[model samples]
Every structure is written in C-alpha cells, then in structure tokens.
Target: MKLLASGVFALATLMASSALAQAQAPANYGPAIPGVCVYYGAQTLAQSTVGQSVSTRMNALSQEVAGELAPYAQSIETEITALQQGRASIPPAELQSRSQAVEQRIREAQQLEQTRQNELRYTLDVQRRAIATAVDPIIVAVYQERGCGLLLDRESVYLMNPAMDITPTVIERLNVALPSLSFNRLQVPVDQQQAQ
Candidate 1:
C-alpha cells in the first residue's frame, strides 16, 4: 500500500511540474513577419562603399608603416650577421656588450612595432565608429519603415529563414546614405597605448 501511494505522489508531482512548464513556455509565433528581422552588421559594414574605402585607406596606412620599419629591420639583420661573422675575433667582454646592445635595439624595434599596431587599431576603430554613426539613422529609418519590433544581429542567430535577413537592403541604404569616409591614421600617445 505504501509503494502504491508513493507511485501516485510521484505521478502527481510530475503532472504538476509539466503543467507549470507549459504555462511558462512562450507562445510559438509561426512564420516571421516584418516585425522580426535579422541583419548581418559585419557583412553590411564590409560590403558598404564607405567600409571598402576605409579598408583601402587602412591597407595603405599599414603598407606605409611597413615601409618605415623596413630599414630598421634590415639594419638589425646586418648587425646580427656581422656579429656572427666576427664572433671569434671579438673579445669575450666586448662580444657580451655588443650582444646586449643588439638585444636592446631588438627590444626597441619590437616596441615600435607594437606602437604602430596600436595606432592602426585606434585609427580603424575611429573610422568604423564614424561609419556606424553615419549609418545609424539609415538603419533606424529602415527599421521604422519595416515596422520591426525585434532586431536581431545575424551573428546571434543559429538558424533563420533567408527571407528574414535584411542585410542587402541595409547595405543598399548605407551606400546611399554614406558614400565614403575621409580619415587619416590616428596617432595614439605612447602613454595611452601603454595604459591599455
């Protein structure tokens, strides 16, 4: 009798929990409407005219920095070669000093490289923000026009209908709204870069 009573209690508890779960579950709204839409923000940025322009400018800046650093790199390489070639003739103490100096120069070169990278990153971030600022209104306008209730970043979505994606439309509007951006490499202070 006790076994039967316990079985009954367990069944009742399971039924109650199932009922609660059903009550808490959200309503399934089948078929996506304009009310729910997704967009690929990164793709829109990459394909947009202003984004391409920024990319080109960033590439140019990177190439320019590389060119500036090339001479220093070549000089370091030559020094290393000379050290290796003259290793036997040089006094032990002098060799140690020369090696230490070369190491210092290498460290300085690495620091300079890191600084240039930070500057490039800062410049790119500024340009991307500028582009976002310009496109924000256009995105808002489209959202309003489409009567969107929920805007989802495509990246967050696992599986979505192709029709729900508004990326191309957003890109089209972005191209019309912002054709190009004029900017230069941002020079970040050494202190600011180091703080990060």
Candidate 2:
C-alpha cells in the first residue's frame, strides 16, 4: 500500500511540474511586420549636394595641411637619413643636439596633423548634422507619402527588392530642400583642448 501511494504522489508531482512549465512559457506574439522602405545612407549622402560640398571642403583642408606640413615632413626625413648615414663622422655633442631637435620637430608635426584632423572631423560632423536636420523631415514625408510603415538602412539589410529602395528619392528631395550647408570650424581654445 505504501509503494502504491508513493507512485501516485510521484504522478501528481509530475503533472504539477508540467502545468508550471506550460504556465511559465512565453506567449507567441507572431512574426514582426517587415520594414517597407530601404535607404542607402552612404550612397544617398554621397550623391547629395551638401555631401559633395563637404567632400570638397575636406579635400581642400587635406591639401592645405599637406602644403603646410610638407617642409617639416621633408626635414624629418632628411634628419633620419643623415643620422643613419653620418652617425660615424658627426661629433657626439652635435649629434645629440640635432637628434633632440629632430625629435621635437617630429612631435610638433604629429600634434599639428592631429589638430588638423580633429578640425576636419568637427567640420564634417557639423555639416552632416545640418544635412540630417534638413533631411529628416523630408524622409518622414516620403515614408508617409509612400505608405511605408517602417524604414531600414540598406547597408544592414541582406536582401531587399529594388522597388523598395527610397535612397534616390530621398537624395533628390534632400538636394532641393538643402542645396548647401555652410560648415564652420569650431574654435576650441588650444589650452582647453586635450593635448594631442
């Protein structure tokens, strides 16, 4: 009789455990609705008028930096070559002083390059932000007009229909709404800015 009672108790426990497991299971919410519109952000930005202007500014800045730093860069190269080739002939004191000067110039050049890069980055960011601010409303209007429930980045999506791509239209509208954005370099005081 005790054995039969134990068996019945085990069966009841199993049944309760099964019921608890089922209760704890998450409810099915079904599949998500797919985004209807895809936008190639990089392509759109590249094709936009503001983007082209930003590119032009960036290129100009690069050229200016190269022009300014070319002499220093050449000096460093010459110093390195001289040290390697003339180490035996150069007196110890002169060699030490020249080495120190070369090192200082290298550090200065590196710092200047970093500063220029930071300024360029800052300008680009400001320009892109302006473009985004101008384009966001247009994107929403296009999405709504097309009856798209959602918009997704084309870069992230693995597969999509060409018909659903809205990049061209977005870029077209962006150019009209924002033909150009003036990028102003932020003047952070050298003292306040971190030592590059």
Question: What is each predicted model's overall lDDT from 0 to 1?
Answer: 0.77, 0.73
Q: Once all C-alphas are superposed, what RMSD does model 2 give against the true structure?
A: 20.5
Q: By TM-score, how accurate is candidate 1?
A: 0.78
Q: List ranges where model 2 is wrong by over 4 Å.
A: 1-35, 184-196
lDDT by residue (103-176, candidate 1, tens digit) is 99899998887778878878878988888898788778877787888889876875565567677888898898
Give candidate 2's TM-score: 0.72
TM-score of each: 0.78, 0.72
**Native-to-model Cα distance after best TM-score fit, residue 3 in candidate 2, in Å:** 79
Per-residue alpha-carbon lDDT of candidate 2 for residues 1-196, written as tens digits (9 for 90 to 100): 2222353465467457546755664565334445588877666666689777776666666566678788989989999899979999999999999999999999999988777666766666677788889888888988888778888887676555556778889899989888876655565457646653
lDDT of 2 at 26: 50
Q: Which ten residues in a row have the lowest lDDT in candidate 2?
A: 1-10
Error of 1 at 17 (Å): 42
RMSD for each model, in Å, please? 17.2, 20.5
